[model samples]
Every structure is written in C-alpha cells, then in structure tokens.
Target: MLIGVNYHYIRPWYDEPYPGIHGITPEVFEHQLKLLGRVGHFVGAAEIGEALAGVRPLPDRAFVVTLDDGLREQYEHAWPILRRLGVPAIFFVNTAAIAERRVLGVHKIHLVRAWQPPEKLLERLGQSGRSGNGGQMGALSDVSLIESIRRRAAAHYNYDDPETACLKYLLNFVLEPAVRDRLITECFEEMNPGAESEISQRLYMSGEELRILSDMGCLGSHGDDHLPLGLLTPVEVQREIERSVERIEAWTGRRPEALSYPYGSAEACAPPVSGIATDLGIRFAFTVERAGNPDLRAPLHLARCDCNDLPGGKAACWEADRLFEEIPRREWYLDEHVA
Candidate 1:
C-alpha cells in the first residue's frame, strides 16, 4: 500500500491541561520516524508521485512523508531533524505569503486570538453583535472556541461553508484582499508592534533556502494565495496554481510535480483543482482524507494521514496496522458540496 503522512508544524510540545494548539515535538517526531524506519520503506513524496505502473509494486509498508504549509518552523526545526535522520520528505509551500510577506487567513486569525480572546475578535468582526457567548464560546476550550466563533458567525458573514472552515472562506474569499490585509496588519501590529517587517521573515523560508531544500528533497506547490481552489473562479484558480508552479520552478530550476491542496481537504482536491493540475502538468495532488493507495498508476487525488492522527505503539507498525489500514469510507466527495 502507498501511504503518505501529512504534517504541518513540528514545534516543542508540552502536556498542557487545556487543548492548547499542539503539534508533534521534534523529539516525538524522531520517535515516530524510528517506528517508520523499522516498519516501512519511507520514500520521498516526489518518488511516490512518479511511481506509476512502469515501476514495480511498492512494498505494503511503503510510505511517503509530507509537510503542509511553508511555515518557518519546518524550515528551521524539522528539516534539521529530517536531514540528521536521513528521512526524505516533501515540503509543500504557499508562495504568496513568501512573495508578498502577508499573513495567511488562518494565521491572521491566530495572531489576533493569540493576544485577544476569540470573543473580543468576534466582537471586532461584530459577528455575534454581543460577545461570542451564544455559540457556547465560554464552554469550549480555547482551540474549540476558535472553531465556535468561526463556524457560528459564518452565517452572518454569508459564507456557504458548513464547518469552522468558513472563517477561512470569509477571510480569504468574502473579504476583499486589501480589506483583509489591513485587518490582519492592524491585528498584528496591536499584538507585536514594530514586527511587521519580520512577519514574512519569521513565518516563512526564503526562496534561496527553498532552492537549497529542493536540492535536498523536493519542493512542491501549495498554491500562491493558499485559498480554497473550489471556491475560486476557474481563472483565479489557474492564477493561484500556475503561479505557484512558475515561482517554485523559477527558484528551484524544476517544475514541481506534486501539488498538495491548500487546506488539502474539502474543495481542496476537486473538479477545478484536478482540472488545473491536469492542465499545468501536476503529476500528483494530495488530500487530507486518510487512505492507503493500493494502486498509484495515476497519482492524482491521493490520500494522506495528518501527523496529529498518526497512531503509536509497536503493534501499530504491523502490515495491517489499523491506523494505516482501514481506508475510511468516503462518499463521492467530489460531488458533495464543498462543506
């Protein structure tokens, strides 16, 4: 089976009482890598993307490692570990943030919430008119409260999405670019004054650094603006996807073959995206929906497990390991609404 593991941040983690935002720490990640090294043939995502029928069948334990988003954390903390362990992986990036030095919609929300309560931010958006309490914001843990505000207030924002993800839609799609940028800048400045100049430098890797990593492993597309492709017009989608490929190609001296969807879920891997990938010569497109690929002759629409959801224990390493096994039953998601 061909499996891909999806990871984002790899920062230091603690057993905080509340469900504070967390990711696998570098130490734990190395433990997981040790498990993978023992049980599977870990391959680069690009090689997996290229392994069509012309190649022999991959071992049942074969897997690829992938990191989503071009967070500076990965380029700093995770890459060193990957290099030390000789573990190859693909790092998918959003070039717009790199090029324009702007905060992503999610990060914009995060920066605000980091300093102020979600209720305060919601009040700022004036989403609920009152504080965000009606949605049970107070009952929820901090992380959950963020979702509460985003999802419950989405209706007021007139976003069509049914989940907490509507905030992304509102921030990235509903609001005009200039308007959203100003909001993010204002929020950022309030929290960390005089930090505007360092936002891009602190948040993402430089192009020269990316080119060097490409030489080490592979660099792939995660769109330019990092918005949901299904939500954009066909022309806009083309601009986002094509420009990412062009920018990465220009920097790395090779057109990227892999294109992991910007959220890598929902509309992230659907009609317009697949069509764009086909047109632009993207060999593989990844999704967050977890599954094992029995056949990879055509690498589009491949499933990946989020690192947070990655299982543990020695038995978890077996060929029939339940985590990697048991492909979750999915509806014809392509036909469903981008919820």
Candidate 2:
C-alpha cells in the first residue's frame, strides 16, 4: 500500500497579522518526518514507479512526502532537513510562479487575507460581484448560498473558523476565475505596489534551485497558473498541463513524469484531466482525496492525505501505526486491474 503525505507553506513561523496561511514550522516538520519514519518506509517517485511496474516490491506501509506549490521554504527549510535525514521528497511546482515571476490568484488571496480581515475580503468580493453582474460572488448576500458555502468550508478547511473558511471557499472555488483574479490582484497590489515580481522571487524557487532539485530527481509538475483543471475547458486543461511540462523541462533539463493536480480535489482532477495527463506522458498523479492506494489500479488517481491527517500533525494520531487503522482504503481499487 502507498500512503502519501502532502505539504505546503513550510516555514519557521507564521507571524501574519491574522491566520491567513497555515502550515508547520521547520522544527515540527522534522519531528513529523522522524515520526513517519517509525511507521513506514519513505519512498520517492522512482521507487513508486518501480513498485507499480513490478520491477521492485514495495515495503509494507510505504509512504512518500510531496511538497506542492514549489515554495522557496521547501528548498530553504525542508530540503536541508530531508537531505540530512535521508528522506526523499517530490516538490511539485506551478511553472508561472517560477518562470514568469507571477503570483497565482489563490496565493494572492492568501496574501490579501493575511494583510486584511475576512470580513473586509467578503466586502470586496461583494463589491466585485455587484460590478460583475449576478455571478457566484453575488451569492455572498444570499443566506442560503452563504450557508452552503459555510458547509463546504467546514468540509474542506476543518481547521479554519466558520467565517474564515467561508471566505476561503468563496475566493478559491466559488468566484469566477477572471473576477477572482481581477479582484484579488487589485487587493494585493493595493498592499504591495509593484511588488509582485519581488514577492514571486521570495515566494518560489528559482530555475537554478529547481534544477538542483531536478538533479536530485525530486521535482514534478503542479500545472501552470495553479488553476483547478476540472473547472477549465478541455483545451484549457491541456494548455495548463502541457505548458507546465514544457517550461519545467526547459528550465530543469528534465521532463517531469509526475503531477499533483492543482487543488487536487475531485472537482479539480476530474475525468479527462487524468486521461490528458496520461496522454502527455505523465506516469502518475495525485489528488487531495484522503485515502491510501492498496494497489496501482488507478495510478493517476492515487489518493493523498494532508500532512495534518498523519502522524505528528495537528489532527494526527498519537500512535503512527494507528493512523492507517483510521484511514479507509481506496475501495475503487478493487474494481480495476492491479498495475
């Protein structure tokens, strides 16, 4: 069986004015890696492919660490610790951030929220909705729509408060991409004038750093623009995947064989997204679906749990062995032929 743990925003501290970005400190990350080491053997992308191809047998309770969004902190903080501990990790990157030095809309929301309050953001979204006509953001004023958003927020972000979660869901998933981008960019620019280039440099790893990671065989594609694929048209999805693969290859001198879907949710990784990835020569993919892969029946739809759902996380079990006991297996694997 394969258990995957996903992480983002690993830093020394989260001293934002408010609770906008949530992640573990380097000390906590190291402790978790050590704890995970006790319960399962750490594997890498190559080993996973080998095991799936029947070239090598996987150890019992094998797990892999994946760092998404290719944040500089992963290289600066997490990579050194991983190197010291002999743990292998895959850093999945969004090419636009690394190549064009642009901040993604989702990250813009994070920075805006950290700078201001959720209520303030909701107000701005409402203003944008008014200007954009009655779109999804207009539902902010509808009691029923607000309630539905609250429920989804609770489901996706159980760690956040009701207000914060609702704000996040609306910004990240509900609003139209064009509207969200325009509104968020306006807000972000208001706070950091002419600083997008500066922020991008600090927020993400450079091509040289990514090349170093590629040399270590730890880099993967997280798509371009970081938009959820399922929400986009088929053509747009292909562009997102292909553009990322091409740019990453050009920058690093290696074509990425793995992908971690942007958002990694069912709505984001649905249908042709996986088939398109396969056609594009991606060997495997990951989703934020919380479960373990008992077999490689659906390599592209492999499930992953958040770091918080495993040992040494906020919602982790006290005993590492007991972790899998609570997580159900991917029952769909029974319906497909084992790879």
Candidate 3:
C-alpha cells in the first residue's frame, strides 16, 4: 500500500492579517517527516511512478511526499528540511508562472483572499455583475449542484471555515472563468500593484532551482495554465498537459514523467484527463482523493491524503489501528475513459 501526502505553501511565517494561505511551518514539516519516517520508507518522485507502472514493486507502507504549486517557499524551507533528513519528495510546478513570468489566476485568488476577508472578496464578486443570485452560472440556482460543490469543497478544503469554503467554491467552480480571472486579477493588482511579475518570481521556484530539482528527479508538472482540466474540453486538456510537459522539459532539460493534477479534485481529475496524461507518457498522476492507495492497478488515479489528515499534522484523521489493514486486490477505477 502507498500513502501519498500532499502539501502546499510551506513557509516560516503565515503572517498575513487574514492569513488565507496556510501550511505547516518548517518545524512542523520536519517533525512530520521524521514521524512518517518511523512508519514508512520515503521514496523519490519517480520511484512511485515506476512502482505504479509495474516496473518495480512498492514496499509495504511506502510514503511519497508531494508539494504542489512550485512555491519558492517549498524550495527554500521544505527542501532544506527534506534534504537534511535525506527525504525524497516531488515538487509539482505550474509552468506558466515560470514561462510567462505572471501569477496564475488560482494564485491570484489565494493572494487576494489572504489580503481580504471572504466578505470583502464576495463583495467584489457581487460587484462583477456575474455573481448576483445565480446571475449567469446556473450552478448557483441548481440545489443539487450547489450541494455537490459544497460537498466537494468541504472534502477538499476541510481546514477552511464555512464562509471561506463557500467563497473559494464560487470563485473556482461557479463563476465564469474569464470573469473570475478578471475579478481576481483586479483584486490582486489592488492588493499589490505591478507586482504580478515580482510576486510570480518570488512565489515560485526559479528556472535554475527547477533544473536542480529536475536533476534530482524531484520536479513534476501541475499543469500549464492551472485551470481544472476535467472542466475543459479534451483538446484543451491535452493542450494544457502537453504545454506543461514541454515547458518543463525545456526549462529543466528533462521531461517530467509524474504529475499532480491542478486542483486534484474529482472534477479536475475526471475522464479524458487521466487518459490524456497516459497518452502524454505520464507514468502516474495523483488526485486529492483522501485515501491510501491499496495497489497501483489504477495508477493514474492514485489517491492522496492531505497533510492535515496524517500524523503530526494539525488535524490528523488517519486510523492508527488500521495502519496495516488488509488491502483488497480489486481494481476500483478502470473505466474505458482511463485508457
């Protein structure tokens, strides 16, 4: 069985007044790494891919640490702790941030939220004319759809407050992309004028840093534009994955074989997405589905647990007694769409 732990935003201090961006500090990260070391063997990024491809057998209780978003704080803070502990982990990056030298819209939302509370952010959304009582995106009027989004949001962002969760759901999944992008951009610029380039540079790892990680086989693709691939058309999804893989190879001189889907949600990792990854020669892909993978039978849809749900985290939910429970050998996700 494999336990994939996912992380984002590792920094020394999360000192924003509202502090929308949240993650474990270096001290907590190191502690968690050391604790995980006690129960499982830490493997490099590619090893898990190989294991899933049946090129090698995975050890019992194998754990893979993955940090998404390519945040520089990951390299500066998490990387050192990982290196000191000889822990091998993957740093999944969004190539657009590096290639275009601009902050991706998803990140813009994070920064804006960090700067303003949900009320203020929601007010901005309301002012957009596309946010009033199910204005254009009909999902707001569909009770079932709203419930579904809420369920997904609650599961994915279990740490967020209700208001914060609702705000994120609306911005990420409800509002139109162009409108959402424009609104977030306006808010981000208002928060930090003329700093998209500067912030993109500061927030993400540099090309040289990426190359170093690539040399260590620790770099993977998160996507090119950071849009939810499952929400896009198959052709668009293919473009996103292909562009990301190509840009990463161009930047690092080594093609990435592993990927952590942007958003990592069921919707984000849905059909044609994994199939596209397979066609692109991606050996394995991860989703934010919260469970330990019992086998590599469904390699591309491998499940991952959030760091908060594991030991030494702020909100640990893993069942201690079931650590070595018998894993059924059934394949649960092998639809025709999976390739």
Candidate 4:
C-alpha cells in the first residue's frame, strides 16, 4: 500500500497552537521529513505508480509527497528544502496562471490586507458593483452591496488579473503609489501577515521553471482553469482536462499521464464525467478527499492525505500507516460473503 501527503504552503514562524495556520510549518515540515526518513521510503508519484503495479517492492513504509497550487512559496521555500532532503515531490500547476504571470481571485485578499477597517474595504468593494468599473453607489440594500462586491472581486481576481477595479478607483481618487502599496501590504499583513507577499506572488509556474522541475521529476497539472469539476458542465470538464494535457505535453514533449482534481471527492470522481482521466489516457489521478491507497482497479481515483490536516507535522506518518493497514481489512470484509 502507498501513503501520500498533500501540502500547499509552509509557514516560517509556526506556532504549535496554530499548527502553522493552515497546515504544517516549515519547521514542522522539516520534522516530518526527518520522521518519514526513519519510517518510510520517500517516493515520487511515478515510483508510487510502479510499486502499485507490482513492478517494484513496496517498502515497509512508503509515502509520497504531493503539493497543489504551484505557489511561489513552494518554489522559494519548499523546493530547496525537499532537494536538500533528497525527497522527490509532485507540484501541480494551473496552466493559465503561469502563462499569464498573474494571480486570479487574490486582489481582494490583498485589499482586505491593505484597507483600514474591514468595513471600509467592504464599502469600497460594495461601491464597485458587479462590473469591474466603479459605478454609482446608490442606497444599496446590505445584501445587494455584499453580493455585488463578491461577484466583482471574483471576476477580477478569479481569472488572470491582479488589481480589482475598486482598487484602481481608490488609487485614482485618494492614495499615491507609495502610500497605496504600503496600505495594501499593511492591510494584507493585518488580515494575514503570513500570506502577504506570498499571496501577491501567487503567480503560476513559468514554462522554464516547469521544465526544470519536470526534468528533476517534479511538477504536474492541477487543471487548465482550476475550476472545481462538479461545478462545470461535462463539456466544460472535458475541455479543461484536454487543454491542460495538451499544454503540458507541448511544453514537456511527454504527455502527463497523471492528474490532480481541483477539489477531488467521490462525486467528482464518479463515472463518465469523472472518468475523464481514463478517457484521456491518464494512468493515475489524485484527490483531496481522505481515503486509503488506490485499489489498483480504481487507479484513477487515488486517495491522498493532506499534511495540513495532521495533528503534528509528523503525526501524518503514523496516520498514513494506520490507514494503509486498514485497507486490506476493509477489502476483506467487502469481499466476504454474508450469511
């Protein structure tokens, strides 16, 4: 059986009480690596595939490391550390973000960080409305104002743009560049200091960086647009999958036979629509949902444990072992005939 851990960011000043905010801290990450080294063989996604195929011996304790979002922090922080530890990990990147060199759906996060009172930010966002343009701020019912801001922010940041229309309008009317930059950064830090610069640099992996990581046996596709599968039409899902595969293939000369679902779950992994992997000739696919190792029969719906969910950074190593052991017992019960 193969155990895997999913990671995104690694925080520096990880307070144990916080568990590094979202998940493990860089300190905890280091600790986890050390623990994993003692207990298991740290394999990459490809090696895990080979072992599951019975082409290689499954180590007494084998686990794979996988990361999503392809954040710059992964490049700036996790990559060097993983290299130093000599552990191979997979990073999944969305094609559009990298190609465009901008982050989608993050300016609000930045604005929230920069603005004074949360109320003020909300007011500015409310004034912006659904259009990216600043419109007339009539007497908006509270719900209307809130909804309008959300829609506009999603549109502005959810694609390939950085600055939201409200941000542009605010700058035009009030603040200078230095003050604006400072306010934005300050607000971001106030809201989430750990993610300030990291959020701003949420740019996707460049083609050159992708190649380098691929050459080093890291990097894979998260998807073309990073849209959640269940939310998209079947036709849209197919296009998302195909476009990602084509783009990766064009860059690497080798089609990526593996994929990670945007927000993977049983419903999202269901037949026909979810079977895009098998249809696209993908050999393996991963999900965010917690489950045991792949059943071999359902190679396309492999399970991965998120490291962020683990109690301590190293706790996942134990949890992974327990889950691996239970898979056989669960399979046996399922296969047993009932009286």
Best by TM-score: 2
Q: Which prediction has more favorable lDDT, 1 or 3?
A: 3
TM-score of each: 0.78, 0.95, 0.92, 0.65
Model 1, range 1-339, lDDT digits (tens) per residue?
Answer: 767777776778544332223356787777787766776788885456546635655666777888877887887888888888888888999888888777676566555645554445544544432354233323434677556656644733331334324444545544545555666667777777876548867878898879987886568888888777876778988999899989888888888888888766555566666777778988777877656666663466777766544554222423434544565533324354421
Poorly placed runs, candidate 1 (over 4 Å):
13-21, 127-182, 313-320, 327-339
In TM-score terms, candidate 4 sits at: 0.65
- For 1-339, candidate 4 gives per-residue lDDT tens digits of 566678876657433321112434677777677765665678886786686578976565567788887666677678888999999898887776565544433333334533344356545545443343333333334676546655554543232223344443333222333334444545555666576345445545567777878777676778876655645677878898888878887887767767888655444444454466568867777765555563444566666766744424543434534545553211211222200
Displacement of the residue 191 alpha carbon in candidate 2, Å: 0.3
Which whole-number lDDT from 0 to 100 does residue 94 have in model 3? Answer: 94
| Ordered list by TM-score, greatest first | 2, 3, 1, 4
In model 1, pairs of residues that clash are none
Best by lDDT: 2
Segments in model 3 whose C-alpha atoms lie over 4 Å from true places = 53-55, 130-134, 137-152, 319-322, 326-339
Please identify model 4 stretches exceeding 4 Å from their true place: 11-24, 52-54, 106-202, 314-339
